[model samples]
Target chain A: MFWQVFLFRVALVAALVIPTPFFLTQAHADENLWGYVYGTDTLPAGANEIYLWTTSRNQKGKGNYRAWDTQLEFEHGFTDRFQASLYLNGRSHQISGGALAEDPDRRLHRGLEFDGFNVEFKYNVLSVYKDLFGLSLYIEPEYQRIDKISGERVNGFGLESKLILQKNFFDDQLALAYNLTLEPEWKKFQATGERERELELEHTVGVSYRFLPHWFAGVEGRYHAVYPEFKKRESDAYFLGPNIHYAAERWWFTFTFLPQVSGNPRIAGRNSNGRQLSENERYEYRFKIAFNF
Target chain B: MGLLSNFDQLTCALSLSSVRRIYQAGDLADDLVKCRLVVLRIKIGFPRQGVIMRTAQWIWLPAACLPVAAISIPAYAATYLTVEQAQQTIFPGEKLAPANIMLTNEQAREIERRSDANVRRKDIKLWKVANGGYFIVDEVVGKHEFITYAVGLNADGTVKQIEIMTYRESYGYEVRNADWRAQLAGKNAAAPLKLNKDIKNISGATLSCRHIADGVKRILATYEIALK
Candidate 1:
């Protein structure tokens, strides 16, 4: 029981610091600023808005982890049909273990990480007949900074881009959207205790559906290929998750789960004989609460 | 795999098909802590369960049933617009006495809609007495306006008072700004009001003075039918 709590805290901390700005931006896009008027199903022109969010996650295991995310988001409507936004996401994670870790004395570890907080501009390239359905293409350029994390620490700029396809049916009763992004990451890691630059690649695909007002559900999958500064080692990671959201009158909540779909160990250095070490992976059940003005 | 284990836990929380399937799932008693997390998500995710559409109908149903709700929501109820009754009660075309009447539901709705659209003078309202006296109700000044020395009938269809309310005119000088309202003293159904040159119209404030005189004239028409 104690171990599960520890794992929950650790997983939450990592998810919170991921700098996933698009999630926070999308939440405010359709909400109204004035209480009387209903917000639109499509982004309104010349509309500028702000949002703040906090997210946490936990894993069901011998250890538990908790994470926190805080972000300030700004979006501007260039035209009635086009809009752009910038989001700044920062987060920290805390991990504790009762028995989840092989090292029983590993009581706690805290680390802060930030993702690519990019300025993304979106244009409504085309609208279907009667503007019933539309397609939007957006490009985001970002700089990611990482302060603490073993083997993953880097201070480098990255470019993340997304193409979204959206459709509205049943007279706006339902909305289905698909989002795809290719996030390129580079970091300066230390080999032989000396700084070295390493390159990484990530691809993400997500689908969201709003079956009811103020409520939406989605699923996302990510493939991360992590290469070391030196050619001696190789590792890869995978995450797939279900995300659910509810929002009403200045309040929003979200929950998600990513159980770490794949983690294959790397072959150790030539000198070690048949000994293995299990690396840390991000496996979490997450929750988020947000308020907007 | 780690993912498979978490998936199993989620399925256990979401699937309620069989009691045995839930309890017999491995470590049900032990993994109750994990199960609690799943339940929290389900509970907070009420909006995703299509509750918004259901709640919208519920809240709008009661309000639309009140007055112009039919015009707003389109289904639950409609306004009672008896045009003939309104014609007789609000604007009776009787020669002897004009109908001084209260507003009908449709008229009230029109006033509200117009006021909202105008935004500048949203505080305007119209009031009616039981008997048949219609007064220009200006809540802005916290007072009522009627013809000078004019008798207002009560709700029971009897003459209530004979008072000179005001005679402020905005246009002409036939009737001075201060004395224009004094012309209607002691006027009743027995003495029809003549708000023309014979009666006296303010020179620059003619339009305003005429409004007061015409207002009294219209009220007399309402009184004729309401009293009968």
Candidate 2:
């Protein structure tokens, strides 16, 4: 157990620092400029990068709640216009005595576990400099062995696709981005032997300013609408947040804090402060770092 | 043996500057001759035997082959132009007197303020043309590389010509197109000089275009405030 923790830490640190020779080049554009919003830039041909992200979901209106979701990603550019990535995701949550867990039989959950794997691809269709604006199409398929929220054993599959758009102004110091995403997921719960399907419609808008050299400050807003079993609307949630980003020659970090501003959830019998606590957390904090070679 | 002796010096030349300088200034015959020279030296150093020369057969051979391999990589990333060549190409039959000037922080700040572009360096490499214009060598951060380019300004502060001096890019080669660069000509400080407005944009080259456009704008602003 100690070695597992130690080796994991060491491997992450080594990944962040070992590729010093990549110092000759700058971070590729495909490196996420925002925490949640997608940028339309693709990596140069033959370039590769590694990304690690940790997001903390906090508060659920009742009881103590905190969950950490971590994802380690490896991305590569096959061509100047196309890029792909693989992600390994893990989650640890402590939700005690709350409706945060959808199943009453699993109200309290704890412990960390490997949860999911995902593959993503991006194709650039237009360049912000060469064309009127930038555009890219993205597709990702994810497989989950454990539930992210309830910490229950399950088999889940999801396909998420997005259309990313970007436009820069003020000498490219200020950038605006929008992403439209559609995701559908299927899950079979081991505890109840129940099957569920969900379709989520999401959109994000972001604007960032390069406040200082290698540093950026921005705000992003996200809206999510979900339908269970592809039926009527089951929930509505919106989040708004601020993010700060700093990028060096070989590495970059982006931190964002998003709080649920409004939502209507069916779980927990009621909504808290007009915010959905059953389906989403009261606030989420994410820190992402990426290294390129 | 000669190749082994020159081996130490050969690896040092692998530095990007020296390698690119050699590759840019060399022709096919010249570059291949260097490659073959290393190979021939190693060939001579190998000892001939009667039956099977297996003792030192592959040993030390790879070390000698290193330089030969390095020399064969064509200069695809970085390309350059000498300052003299740039001056002559921009202004033929005109004498350019070296009039390099250093910008004070205040002047640089003012240029940045007027152009709305950040100033990374304050030292400007400038020359005064015998004709009524000026030539300035400048560099801007491309999408991933530092693009060194030269700009000529007419006496009235309008751009005369722009020449890329040193270009290194993994992608976004469209910025090097003559037509893309030519659009910046005849523009002055007052021009919008913004991407997709006064100057057109090329896909996959947005940052390159923005930085180069901002660079030209900064130079024009410099001319308006300091040089004028």
Candidate 3:
């Protein structure tokens, strides 16, 4: 009886802590200036979810501002442990108080296919053991066509692979996680001599507390190392953010702020002429709302 | 005094003492005798009414009388009822026994009819994503559809599982974000799945999070109702 009780408790802790590593790449549009992805852990089979959020980010020195991004997401379980989902996001950036002054017409940018969308498939590879640990794998790739300031159209596909690790301590009230993200992009520039490919690797570590029933707060710091093969000089950006979330019976909401603490300087301009890039990173504020059926 | 008279008096005293001891040890003790005498006293004074007479007349009889009659009636009653009637009314079948659990064909058809009726009644617009799964949009926002899905959670609301029943959006990037959903495994369902909360908001996919979280809440609500 004693061993059984101990095992049960251990299993509960595993269920809460493990299986987090598989969901690390998909970010809420509220906190990120970029679009949204749909790969996350499978909702319990037969369960479903919808999430929406918007956010804006600014450079640390208040230049190179990104506009608010809107996101809508839906996910469902087809079995007891496996789940699938579809997600869509639209983003518009404004050069508010930034060096790119002539970029006021964000709509023209949209015509270049600034918006991106993708589909995701996920499976709970393992969750039935002791429930102490869970495993899942997801794959997602997206494409968007955008017009640069030089009037050149760029079509790019972003491929991302993420590993999420969830660990629990102190009777399942506290959870710690490490997430690794790999993003590779293929870009084709129209009528431009610039190389049309770029890649970024992002790593983040986070800890969350189940402070109240269906409520949680956590802090995550991410380091994004951009390796632009087109541009020889590599750059890395760092962000620190605090998040607040509320999940109700049929809906959920989230808010967060991420300040770009550090970044590398842009060595040279490829498509744009006579442009001076800022050395400082950007800041972001985000909010999201979601409902389930 | 004469010798014979004295002997007779001694014998009478001895006999009385033996009787007293026997009464104390046996069922005819003082408490029983008192209780019996009280009952007799009450019975003697009661009027000859039918109700009182019924008890007065029955109490003196043997205590085994009613039990014997009760036992005999059940035996006779069991023999009289038909097998079907006995099976239905007399006893619940044991584990080894077989019983009917079949539904009529009409009833089965009725269930299917109701399911189709529900599908026709709701405003659901379905779309197939390029990667996988069909999206059912019950609500429309601008040109995009606001899709909803369910997230099954445990008692603590940690994500036990997830299901996407409806959606209409880009499938590639959104579908790739599927792994990101695991971040919600330990989240509190009563709270919001915000970036500022315990979850890590994805860089490009914040908008998708909102729709997914909303769908999760709806699913949890259904689970709650079912539990009750």
TM-score leader = 2
Model 1, residue A242: distance off in Å is 3.3
DockQ of each: 0.02, 0.04, 0.01
How much lDDT does each candidate structure score?
Answer: 0.41, 0.74, 0.42
Q: Write the per-residue lDDT of candidate 3 for residues B1-228, one digit (tens) a residue.
A: 244333322222233234445566666656644543332211222122222111111111111122322332222101222333323222223111322123345543443243221111122232222322222222211002333343434444345444343443322134225577666665543545544365555433333454455444433332232221
Model 1 interface Cα RMSD in Å: 22.3
Error of 3 at B61 (Å): 90
Model 1 Cα lDDT, one tens digit per residue, A13-66: 233323232222211243322111112233445445554443433432345544
Instruction: Give the 10-residue window scoring lowest on summed lDDT in candidate 2 chain B.
Output: B50-59
Q: Give the top-scoring candidate (DockQ).
A: 2
By lDDT, the better pick of 1 and 2 is: 2
CAPRI quality of model 2: incorrect
lDDT of 2 at B181: 88
Q: List the candidate 2 regions with Cα displacement exceeding 4 Å.
A: A1-14, A20-27, A99-101, A104-110, A266-271, B1-127, B137-149, B153-205, B213-228
Best by lDDT: 2
Interface RMSD per candidate = 22.3, 17.5, 34.6
- Residue B41 accuracy (lDDT) in model 2: 22
